[model samples]
Target: MGHERVHLLKKIQEVEFAAVELQLFLDTHPQDQRALMEFNHYSRELMMLKQQFEMQYGPLLNFGFSPSQYPWRWIEGPWPWERQY
Candidate 1:
């Protein structure tokens, strides 16, 4: 809800988009090492951002993803559809 949270979410979206695009490229050009490296870099960035967001805000997923804190904090935050972005 805050500006910082919004910015981080935007960054995560951007990195995820890049990763998807690189994946598509690699699907056709499987031997392109450069694309593979770029995909890995973006994947790493996305993972870090997701971890940071989860630590500060809450789990971004409902199950089988980020570890929940004590008292089950995953259900404590706003649902994705309820958020204003």
Candidate 2:
């Protein structure tokens, strides 16, 4: 579980980074269709990965980024930085 969680989180981070980079590129090049397509693709991919992560483990973020279960899940351990690959 721990190893899988770490791997999944890494994927999420990588996709998110790509999305953000594409967004920045688009900001200066709005006419670039390829960049826009890639940005949207990464955005959707990031959302799916995040959902999978939260469901299998717990909410990946707080302050409305991800919802908690009956009790707050934001406080659980093995947080992103604490996980070992």
Candidate 3:
């Protein structure tokens, strides 16, 4: 909901897109080391983003929801579809 969270969410979205694009490319060029490397990088970033989001915001999925030091305010925030992005 703040500037930092917004920035993190944007980065996570970008990484997600990049990973998906790389996946499509790898489908045809599975032997391409460059594509593999990029995909791994993006995947790592995406994982980190997800973890950070959960730490600061809340679970990215319903199953991941957990109680934090304070009440999980993120549950009250937008669902993925409802988020402005």
TM-score on alpha carbons, each prediction: 0.89, 0.91, 0.77
lDDT by residue for model 2 (15-38), tens: 999999999999999999999999
lDDT of each: 0.84, 0.87, 0.79
Number of the candidate with higher TM-score, 1 or 2: 2
Clashing pairs in 1: none
Cα lDDT of candidate 3 equals 0.79
Error of 3 at 7 (Å): 1.0
Write the residue-wise lDDT of candidate 3 on 1-85 in tens digits.
Answer: 5667778878888899999999999999999999999999999988888888878666667654544446655556665445563
Rank candidates, TM-score, best first. 2, 1, 3
> Quick one: best lDDT, which candidate?
2
* Winner by TM-score between candidate 3 and candidate 2: 2
The predicted structure with the larger lDDT, 1 or 2, is 2
- Which candidate wins on TM-score? 2
Error of 3 at 1 (Å): 2.3
